[model samples]
Target: MRFDQQFLEDIRNRVSLSDVVGRRVTWDRRKSQPGKGDFWACCPFHSEKSPSFHVDERRNRYKCFGCGESGDHFKFLMETEGLSFPEAVEELASSAGISLPAPDPQAAFKAAKRNSLTDICEMAVRYFQQVLQSPAGRSAQEYVQRRGLSAETLSEFQFGFAPPGRDNLKTALLAKDVTEAELVEVGLLIKPEDGRPSYDRFRNRLMIPIHDERGRAVAFGGRTMDPDGQPKYLNSPETPIFHKGTMLFNVHRARKPAFDAGQAIVVEGYMDAIALSQVGIKGTVASLGTAFTEDQILRLWKFSDEPVICFDGDVAGISAAHRAVDRILPALTSGKSFQFAFLPDGQDPDDVINAGGVSAMYAEIERALPLSEVVWQRETSQARIDTPERKAALEKAVEDLVGTIKDERIQKRYRMDLRLKLSNLFYEESRRNRGPAQKGGGGGGWRNNKQGGDEDRASTARMEAPDTPAYGVERSFCTMCLMFPELFERHFERISQLTYSNELHSMFMTALVRIATDLAEGTVTQIYNKLDERFYKILQEAIVSSRPDEDSSKASTLQRWDTLTNRLQILKEDPPEDFVEHLFLNYADMLELRMLEMELEHETRAMEENLTEESWSRFQALKQDLTRRREDCLRDEQELAERGTKMKLNKAAMRG
Candidate 1:
């Protein structure tokens, strides 16, 4: 008796393969892929050491490399328990809490039709595989080889080729009693609207058979070998057995590997997925040349909570990622969501692998943005929010996007985070627009003036504002940016606009800009290699200047960066919400003050030389400006010292 398709699907979803298979198999954790829902063991049919059998819980399929047997739970039960197909179904249904309907005539017919379609798909796959080895497939063979695919990898994936001859596949399938109508129905042959004869849909292309979760071929993805090919890649047209939007390319193959690594990566195309797999980064799948649908995203979550959506790092690629995020946001659950990976500009997985190998590609993967960060960046990156009206619009846009989230707790949290981000942005902007004195510059009062010569007073003035020690202040800021390159991502433009006070400051700032640009493009090594020895010495000085006792060789980048952040946090009373910008403004103030002091020194010299009216006027103006600037600088220093002392006392009280 045959069960309904819906009933079978229910059972499949309810009962996990690992739960059922684990009851019978002795699972070896060491043999299994870490976190990939893989249960590895010796083949149950024939006992042997060193497990070659793998049961992938994510896909609900099991395969035995030793015995050449593979299938879903139903097939496994029938073979292992020596039960009939109906008995196996009944057993699984009972365990899965599914009630099967009594067999009907229509059910039997539908089941038979489904079996025939499955058979046809398998037959076509075999035929294509055979043709791949034939003399006519030399170009196809070369294509795979040129892509660095070994013979083993080719056979493992069942790679194939279709010849240029229009009637080749049609004639071969028809000879095997696969009717022309069946070929058309399966999307192997194209039927014409005009009076022209039907011909092959995929000609002179590399054929990759796409399999269902049960490891049965359902459709094909074909790639053209021709350089001038119109559509570089093509997939089987939507047929009875295959739904394009619902399916992930190479998902069947990637499921176990993805589960093992605790990561599932979705690439832009089939070749990108394959290229990653070849380099030991397994469990990578590709979208079928379409924006990821809700179903596809959910399907990916079965293997991992945060599947990385890796696309090219170009404008079009970024746009595709934003579109994917929009599609995925509504379906996001508490523990499940999508991460985005952008390959270097104009580079795909193959390009990255060619340039720097698997580790470099993995580093890029590590940089994949979280869903929240992606959302925040997408809404903010496109436009500037300088005015109150524009800022309100930005806030409303964020609210609308977050409104789409169905989870109330997640929605509330997202709203709070976004509000805080907006607050930070505007608060920093306000600080920037305010006058220099009010912008946290100087704190010392003019009432406590000391008598001294012009140069003596200038020297005394430098000692009063010790927080920004002139010799090391520029180096310290540059060090923080170098150690935490993410700082550069947000402040690169501001830093570029800064005027340095000395040659050392200028050179350090230039190197910082170069490194930031390279870091953004995922090409840091290239730029770092081109730097001169003097640059290294500058870097070393920056590191040592920040922490006099810090072992520059042993300090981790993150440790140094954290130290910088901590230093900034304690440097003021109620620190600016945006600390990076605060540091930048401080640097700008320092540069401006230095220029004013230089002018004062020049005027003093000119006054001593001539004592003319113009010199006297300029000298008075210069001295007045310098005195005001020195007081402002001193005030800032006192405020910072007070904040630092209060913080230290608070920490002491806490310890007490």
Candidate 2:
């Protein structure tokens, strides 16, 4: 009976590959490759010592390198378990919870036949598990204990033992009404090609039942307790329901936890996955023996937007991680990404736990780099950028890699960020080539005047400072004094006399004067500590907006503070080099005069409405104060104008 393509795909998706292969193969964690998501076990077919068999649960396929055997679940069953093609499909369909097509007689017959085979496999599992608890299974139990497996974990993973002796399983299952022919067909009993009588296939081995995604036992993985055992570990042959590549070790149990955590972690082996789970990091899985494939990534993304691929810190592990990164990029989509975590040298997840407990393993995982960071580091750090050509090539390499991102918005952002980094790198290089003259200095705008060689330093400083009695001038002075408190030493008395209309400005200026007076060698930190929290935030904002050119240089603490203060002071005042100090004084007086004017106007308005004696007296006093302040401000401005003209005349006479 032909099945619909959609139905077949649905069944395949429902039954995970790990489940099917796990039932047949005990994961030999020692043989697993780190970061590749490859699970390994001894070849179940024509096995000698050592494991050449790999199961890639993510790909839903199994392959034995030793025998060159590879296939999906259906192929495995047909070849190893003596099931026909129809029987294999029926077995999978049933396990996948897929109902066979209605009105199909052959489908029903095959389904029934497959159900019987599955029952035989289940009965075999029970027999093996029971034997492991018997006196004959003592060695297997000891081995499990030595490996540090808890009894609960052993039971949960269905640890068992096959007693030594040819007919052990045969005699046990046959008593349960299982036929010899059925046992032979399921590969539980061996029938030699030369026509020898069938006997038990596994003997004197610790057995682990591999369960499908549905937790149905379909195959067995056996580990020999004997030190001199020919094959240290063995797995059940590919049966109608098991394939290695399409599965991940422990994924059945880890999937929900991974989904909950918003991430899934891919480790190298089953033991690593299990150990992590034991430590409370439950969303861990091992790739069956192969490099991470696109299918595996897709499956991981179902559980998490970003799955961390953790590998050993060795050469092979790094290579595998990079390979996985490269593979994931082409298929990258919006909101989907991968992180790479490399374990320390000579350490696996198990070693990490043994050394520093589970937290150590978590520490390693926490250091995982996002996909873009890894790619950027890989490209830029490895490139030679001594020459212009090489630097250009490095930039091109970054752009080329970023261009692979299909999402236009993401691609555009990458381009922007990458370009900025490139620009900064080159800009720094140019500055280094130019050397010390690039550093900012000279009081007021004098340094820029000299460096720029535009107008004379004196003339530029005069041209730059503005004489306007502007609002916020007090804030400018206070911010400057806070930044470069040394400047406050000479002007402290004048600063103390200043009053601010803005409450926040008043508090900030007061705090600055107090801090500068208390600390002999005034430090920004000292002033910062004395400030109102909001004023401290204002100070930081002032610093950030102070000097753009001086920001890049690595300045000493005092120098940085001074530069910040000086830049802001220059921004507030437009005066010749000698007149900068006078300008600051004038700026403070103008602020005070403006406040007096505003107070006078308010008092006058109240007097006009109420005509009360108290209001009239207050209005009269305010008017008197405003008149005195305006007169004093005009006198100061006139004095500043005359002083500037005298300085210009002196400069001209010196030039002549």
Candidate 3:
């Protein structure tokens, strides 16, 4: 009966949310925009004349402003018809013409055991609540008062206490016909190896029930009253019904509020969660343990768009936050990521509230940093970047980390943002250390000169030779442009990339690009007049390798280049549009191939320098892309030749 998210989304995407909800309520014409996939209707859960129920087809979710009811297609059907989760999914799938996956017997058996264990845990919850209200719970009552917890919070969270004994919970549950093995299975009792008898896991401690998303009690967290307790905090051991890594405390209660506020807060423990919730910050949950797993991170996304991990600003908190970045990177997509908030040193959620009340805690939340900033800080905060080798190492480390991101668009963005920061950092350091002689020099190689500089050269060098092997490709791209200067108008983006193997070709292209763009209706003589003496002087030497047998005399060098362009025009008589596209694709693909090969080679060297899973995966991805693009390049040429042959045959028949 368990369905993955993809299957649910598949059904949701196929059916219109409004069509489903329309069956229950009439649409409000004054506020609805059917074309935009936004609709407003009256509350289906409660009676209201004014429409507060909204269905947004773009998000495929409906929200009720009156009753505070919100959910998706399946949730709507389940709530309206009083159907179970599986029945609702089956209804949606049948309507959407989608088939459900076959049921798994193993999964069904596991679900049955989990449901049974949950029942026992519920029984334990009742026992704890009873003892909490009895005379034996007087100590627990005083402790809640000392912590500034109100009567409402104590009753709302079902706060309880475990008596100081080996068989307090066991004896109570056994009298209810709960077997000893069932108690042990749900982590309520601890079985010893010495054949001594199983006892209660939590003793003389404050108890908080851990609930699943559906608000089913599955486990418990206990905090000790003794100041010198060996472990100040303890959580339930893993059971069929409870998984520490997969569940977050207070998530069930926080989900709706988090959705309304468009944010979620994460603390370390359930105590922090209670403190924040008591202070009216209800859109908060706590990671069950020290480790934040992939499943928990995704669950946070379900409640809020950008969930913030609020931790203390001390060393331990910052270190823990840094470790979380790696776990989040591989799963990052376009807009999905975590923000981090650090409380002041020597402060927890309780301390923050005590010192400044709720507004002060809100201020801390306002200062939360984005996940990208955390990545930058984690990389540059501790490393030494005073030397080129160190700088290269830093860049390589960041590249490897960014490469772990599965989304190509997000990975490219991280590269751009971090590289800009790196440039500024290095530039400031250079300015501070630069002597009087180096002041006139500008920083223009990679960043200011179109984002290709020392970093590209260092990170993507060929393994075979010290010099780049992409020179021939760069030379051809330049020659084609010098012949067909009109190419500047059409393929501006690729030309501007200037990802060249040689500096002189890149410089020449930059100069030509400026003349083509900056000048208004540039004529041949106007272009010649605009060229500086030094630039005109090296135009021949820069292009000498393109034509070695030609004379290098300064007299007719410019004339010789013009002559070659005319000759190419006469010899190439294909259709203009096809010819131009072919030329652009050929040049662009060659440049890309050369650059990618060098990057692949350099990645091998980088792996040898520091072998890691991220680097190895990146290298393999580059190789795959290179193979795919190489085939695409050949396909382009073949398609072009077929078009050319068809053109020739059609013209011949027309003449006949």
Candidate 4:
């Protein structure tokens, strides 16, 4: 029995592929990232010493390098177990909590009719292509040429044209024995409400065929050739095979390249997709000119976990990105998310490419902003949090949006990220910017002021008031972000998510990120000047400036030197660039373990309050994660030390 594609999709989306695979194999903890839905285990079909079987739960598919065996959830069951295809489907459906549809004769009939309509669409596509090649499509050909689309591109994308007549396509299709109702049903011909004959739906436009995964022409997206066209671009009405929200243009063409590249590019227009494809950027697809949908986001995840959304840098494009962020937040999984690549003011991908070539377009991609940063920026861009109530409102606005995330792990991470940012923001707003104060005979740096008032106490509580055991690590990451923002751009998403234990350090981060994203260079001096006086002490602690008046005998002086020596080892002359990144990540790992410990404390309390199986499992998972991170931290530190020693020895050899 054939199943509905959507029904199968529903089952696939709801059922966890890793959970099924986990029952059969022990995941290699070192290689498997459960949070990312990516797992590695030895191939079950072929015996292997090392893990060669890989699973991408986001895509609900698995592949084994050992035996070249690959498939989705149902495929895995059919191959692993002795189950038939139908049996596997039923099992997965049952697990997904979906009721199987009763067998119906009409279902086959409807499916056949739907396919017939798709064939009719193919015929219409050929008809449009024929007219474009002939003398009648001169204007459309001119438009194509002017857009810099080559003949190869035109043929590859099946670029076509419709003449300026309502009945032109209808008459041609009807002559081939296509029924008027069938033509109207497939969205090729529009049926007039009045007592008039059906006419063509697309006219005087450059027609681009929209295909499905099977490479069948299911719909048409038309760009108007007329200069004063009202809508500018028109698409087919929702037909049996064409649903705008779930369909992306060039999916059949882009999927392989996107999967191969391990990334995908989402553009706002098909013309942009075609242009990029022409320029060798094959992993690009265009969204239907509709509001971004959750279904579309999920579908994109099949191709790439963090697909880049390249929208125009104009007002409308920015608006679309914001709307996509709103639609994407709820559907964000642990590993699956989106990034935004905004072009120069009023520029799209095509414009950038035309002016500076493909490299310019890539430069835009390199600077794409993470979804979290986008949300953080949108909330804080025009925000004024001078008063406590305003700060609460700011927190509420961001928290309400983040709370919409369905995944518990991702939601918690977002919550921590927000608290860190807001801590910086709130502390800056409420801090009394005092000048250099006499603390321990001015030998020590800024002393911790005794914060009072309910608001101040609440701020401290939300920010995790006390310094963590990994305070040194937190300061290192914060310092790196401020001092070397460019070197760590690749790790910006992870660094930005780190919850800085110190409020002033968090504030420095918030400012640094804000400036960096605004197309300005992020410098410690810029942040220092822009921030309140409280950040001065934090900055001094991070970069390690000379304080001649400091007494060496003092504990605070000793503490400052200790922090500088232990964490900021880069100061011991030049290290390998890669080593610096690894050191940065090492610091990140320690801080993550610190945050996990805090989570462990909370989960322990909740488990005590309610001794349920799920709570117990969650608590254990946290404990396991904390343990694993500690191991990773140690491993990283050893590697950094070895590499650092090697670098120092090499430098000494050069000097000799």
lDDT score at residue 60, model 1, on the 0-100 scale: 78
Report the Cα lDDT for residue 227, model 3: 76
Candidate achieving the largest TM-score: 4
lDDT of 2 by residue, 142-166 (tens): 8877766787777777778899998
Candidate 4 TM-score over all chains jointly: 0.62
Off-target runs (Cα >4 Å) in candidate 2 are: 1-121, 162-207, 218-240, 380-656
The candidate 4 region of ten consecutive residues with least summed lDDT is 439-448
Query: For candidate 3, lDDT tens digit of each residue in 366-481?
Result: 66777876787788767676787787788778878988999876675565445544554455345436765433112222112223222222121111221456655565566566
lDDT (C-alpha, whole model) for all candidates: 0.69, 0.65, 0.72, 0.73
Off by over 4 Å in 3: 2-72, 75-109, 435-656
Put down candidate 4 lDDT per residue, 174-284, tens digits, no spaces: 899999999888898888799787788898988999998658899999988889986898999998899999888998798767755657999999999999999989999
Model 4 residue runs over 4 Å out of place are 1-104, 431-474, 477-656
Task: Write the residue-wise lDDT of candidate 1 on 376-456 in tens digits.
Answer: 768766545668677677777887898899877566556544553454344434444675432421111111212321222
Local distance difference test, candidate 2:
0.65
Looking at candidate 1, what is the lDDT of residue 479?
55
What is the descending lDDT order? 4, 3, 1, 2
Q: Using TM-score as the measure, name the better of candidate 1 and candidate 4.
A: 4
